[model samples]
Target chain A: MTDIRAKLRGFVLEELVYCEDPDTFSDDEDLLEAGLDSLGIMRLIMFAEREFGITLPDTEIEPDMVRNFNALTGWIESHRQ
Target chain B: MQLLEDFLANLSSHPRSCCLVEGGLRLSYREVAEKAGGVARQLLTLTLPEGYPVAVALPRGIDATCAVLGILASGRCYLPLDLKAPRLRQRWILEDSRAVAVIGHAPWNDLTLPWITIDTISPTPLEPLPLEMENLAAILYTSGSTGTPKGVALSHRAIHAFSDWAKELVSLGPEDRIAAIAPLHFDLSTFDLFSSLSSGASIHFLPEGLTIAPSHLTAWLSDTAITGFYSVPSLLSFWSWKGNLSASPLPDLRFLLFAGETFPTARLRQLAGYLPHTRLYNLYGPTETNVCCHWPVERETLDSDHPIPIGYPACGDRLYIAPRHNELWVQGPTLASGYWQQGQLHPFLNEEGWYQTGDRVGRNDQGEYVYRGRLDRMLKVSGHRVEPAEIEAALLSLPQVIECAVVGIEDWEGIRPAAAVVMQQDEAIPTIRALLKRTLPTYMLPSTIRRLDSLPRLSNGKPDLVSIQAILTR
Candidate 1:
């Protein structure tokens, strides 16, 4: 899970264009409040699907599941086959 | 002036109709009129001369709308300074307009003019002042390439004519609930604020801080029962790409109008697929002429993948093509008076009283005007002039290319055309480059074709040229 969190942060900076330092976030910080918009969420979801082979449920992906780094990683860990 | 007077009179009659909604707060037309009258009475207390420009620096919401109408009722024109712009930019606009006062509650103690706080105002009945038809209504500043923003001075006569035409063209009525998506400073806001106000329709503003949140935005659209949507193409693309459009279609939406920038054909097709019931329109114009031409998208044309024609001239405007270069020149009552700088008229107007649009266009086989590119965007490469849009169109024809922006970068070998491309999923960059080499002419091919995750966009969602240049140099 720690490795997944680090990889997710790397993708957030490079692909999502977060424009923030990687070390600025804690595990449970609100990513949406910290400048992670829906555009970033979409990109991150696609990245998770491609990299980890975890298919996020298209209709059931509530915004709360991606609210923070911990929630995102936990959701992916639960869903990955 | 009579049209405006009648519109205000009608609003005063309909007291219970919802006039605006912002930040989870809704106000009726009667309440808004009274609030505006209160501000107008306060402006009278300031004793500023008629026709003076007053700056409104509030956020895009109900208070800002009331402030503008109040200033207009006080027989003074209002300038909306975008609060989110750089402080230097806001100050430059305030200095250039030489405004008498700024009405807002934002904390930045840099103003030399008088300030009127939006919170301190109280509602009172005030009679509207009589004004001439040619009185200056608003001054919208466009970003200049040379770093100095040029103010486009529009008159009451111009907006009245344009809004009257728009109200009829879109068949707007009191039943329409128009979305106020654009900022107050953008020219698209004119339609959102005035046209809806004139027709007694409700203007629903997306709440502050939630505009870019697609889930919240989609939910709000359905919750508010919005009937008419107006925005730039970039916002529409973002909504269709990232928002839950397919999962929950907005059943109440009837029309989707976009302007202020070019809408890529692929994105438009995707949106049309998402909302098959909604009618889509592509409006074209600069800030000088507020939406001169428009195209109503047809189902057949969407499949052809041809660049959408800007369509016929609306708002009683006349379009003339330059014989040599086919540059579009617009002439009509809707044209802005001129660029304002220190009370002097700039050279935007020609000897024949037409605003040179600087857009190169030509009539296609169907007798519709097709946009080629901007005349100023023409670049010379290898002693041959190449239009970047031509190259972009060719690249977009390839199945792998989803979006592309072509710009000219200066090198030791003079100006060279470079493309920043966003490809479809899993498509390789080299495939697009090889496809472009086979399809385009040798001189028209981009010297450097770079793939990007996304194009850097401005606050208004148009592609940022300075950022594109930075990427090219890097």
Candidate 2:
């Protein structure tokens, strides 16, 4: 399985084109204005769902909430409850 | 001629006029016409269904401009799908409109349609725009929250009527180069594109992401030598607050047009002082009816202590207020055929063929309509009739808010009016709330009044209510 950080790093690196390692990018970086499009969140959705065997609801995901590496992962952690 | 016919006729008369511009790039009238013509020839070869909506999915700019003209010239209706909107939005437009084909670039190659990737940046030149005004010109898709995006069908006649009034509204001539601000998907672009072309004037399409920045907007206004600019009040307010237009070189732009929502008197005053003689016009209409009413404002009207009236209906059209300040009804040549997937026409349009604008409006003593707010937005909170527009209007009248939106939410507690506001820089948020208490009833005073950095807007220049809801909930 892909390490979650690697997965996050690769996704951000590929799309945003700049910036560095996923370990450095926190979970709270507002991704909407952070050069990441919603497509970045979409990729994260499929990755999290496939890895955790849980479905992410559209109502739960929005452009404003998923701005950084930490926020996307945090959303997953909170939803697990 | 239908709308396309009028454009084609006008384009033929002035072949050398600058039709599309981006950065240093420019396309003349003859060049655009030839490209659209070639596209028309190619479209004739396709096995398209009659009344088929050809999806033009691209960001607004020079390429999308030509694509729209080409779709009309090809004798097919074009549907502008905002590339910046969510993929679901793009997919929704195609599926709902049942588009037969799409004209896009390589980046959008994966979009589902009988796709034609026409790259204007390549060495290939554009063909002429095809079609008469009698044909379907474009099918514009406007999305409502919680449902599929509905396509508004406009024939050549609708666009013609709109452009005819638009050209007349501004009296645009060859020397009048207007700054094209809104995206292709937005109807506001009608003036800059068709109206400019109709009069052999130039359209300088600003580069993507240039519309928002205050500094960038000021630079474009001066460098492009734009005679006029069209925008919503929010943007105009930003330019005014930044004091970017204070310079002489920064376009004492002849005309400033505001639509989509009411222009606060504060905003109007700031802009009016900057460009003293500039004709400030307040245009009102929904996408369903194009522009049905216009109120040309002088600085004098702004001084009056009344709700700013939206002015009189222009073109072959008229506006009427429903009884008791209910729905606003519009009738005219610019009325769209109906929503593409329309099960029923807009509820406001009764048997008489008037477009029912869900917008609620009241009239001043002069019999001019003062736009109150959307009738559909009324809330039955705690068995009480609550119109957010009322609260917003009162807040705006208080001299603090540049613009604001009042939304109602019913949680476990009770129903309450929650306001999200954008304030003038010198003003404090607490002072606004204090003022609201003095003027408004206790129940009417917003339980939660929050200030936003800036209100988000959809491509159509209206507040992004969905995004706003998210912001408030967060």
Candidate 3:
């Protein structure tokens, strides 16, 4: 689970949040307000699914599920078979 | 409805009919008319000029709709400011438009303009103000190449003509429910708001943040039973790529209208497969000219990988192609009156009354106008029109930035703005980006910024954009 959180943080910092410094981004920071647009969200979902070998349910794709690093890691962990 | 005033007047006959839906809130024609009338009465007390501009800065909801209708009812042109846009850009527009007042929830404390809070206004239905067809209706701002945003000033006549055409083309009726997915500032909302209201159709305003979630958006479309859908091709493409459209077919959707950017043939074909019963149209136009040409997607035309043609003219518009460069020119009632800049109205149409759309096109064997490319360096990033010059200007505003070149970088999603900057110090990149965020919208911001010692220039000392694009990609 810790490894999964690290990977998600790295992907978001490098791809989604372009202007934010990775060192300063808190674990609970709102990704949506940090410029995670629709395109970025779509790409992030795809990346998570591919990286974790788990399918994130489309119906659960709400703001709360991917609001931060902890929420994203938890969502992915629950879906992993 | 021939005039915008007629839309509200005709609503009296269907007083009990549904007019707008946002989330769990639903408004009838009578309720909407009364609220909008209250807004008009508030504006009338101020005694503004006949065609004075009023800025509307509010979230996308029922109140925003009422504010626009109220402004229109007051016989003043409404300038919609996207609340999600950068504050500095919104301020620039408000300053440039010379708005007399802002109809919003809270007072714009920074600006000295009068604010009319919507919730505080009491309902007092008033008759629509008497106005001529030539009176100004709305002013929409777009990215400009000269560093400042250009305001497309449209008259009531232009909107009526386009809405009449749209209403007839889609056969919109009182039973139809249209989705207002586009932002209020975008020209696409013209069809969603004006055409639907004129046709006595109910428009459902998709809540903010729902647009980013494709699955949720698809579910909403199905749950709401939306019959008429209009948006940019990029959004539809994204939904089709990720949303569960195949599993949950929208049987009630009668028409799907897409404009703004070119739709990839493959993605469009996939959409057709998913929504076999729905009609698809490729609408083509700039903000200067509201939907001049469109093509009804044919089953046979999707056989090849090539893009679809822009098809024949609509809205009583005539197309003229420049012989030398094949640039498309439009002349019709739908063309905007002119551009408003720095408190001056500059005529956009030529002496002969032809608006030159900076789009290049060629005639196919079937006489259809095939879209070739843009005649200028404007980049369409996910259906948002971005002028590289605007981004370059924002970069050059910083003191440390000596030179810069902004270009489009194509990736899996689509084209995005990328910049190559030659600055005195590399440490200023973050600060420069932060400053730019205050002036430009998120879509207009450069996706990648790289510092270079110098920009590649041509023999004439102009930046070689081709080389710059190669370097940015490499």
> What TM-scores do the predictions have?
0.76, 0.69, 0.95
Query: Candidate 1 lDDT, tens digit per residue, A17-80?
Result: 3322446557687766554544456557777888888766544455677778888888888876
* Candidate structures ordered by TM-score, highest first: 3, 1, 2
lDDT of 2 by residue, B280-384 (tens): 888877777888888998677777656578878777787777786577888878888777673222333688877787788877788787787665765433222
Model 1: residues with Cα > 4 Å off, grouped in runs: A1-81, B49-51, B343-347, B377-474
lDDT of 2 by residue, A6-81 (tens): 6655655433322334345555666555444322344455556766667655334554445566666666666666
What lDDT tens digits, residue by residue, belong to model 1 across residues B33-106? 88888989998898775445889989788999999889888888889986654465578778877778899985
- Candidate 3's C-alpha runs over 4 A off are A1-11, A18-20, A46-57, A74-81, B426-428
What is candidate 2's TM-score against the reference?
Answer: 0.69
Better of 2 and 3 by DockQ: 3
DockQ of 1: 0.18
lDDT of each: 0.75, 0.67, 0.85
For every prediction, compared with the true complex, DockQ reads 0.18, 0.02, 0.46
Predicted model with the maximum TM-score: 3
A1-81 in candidate 3: lDDT tens per residue? 889989998888755675536777888988888888887787788888888887776677778888888888888889884
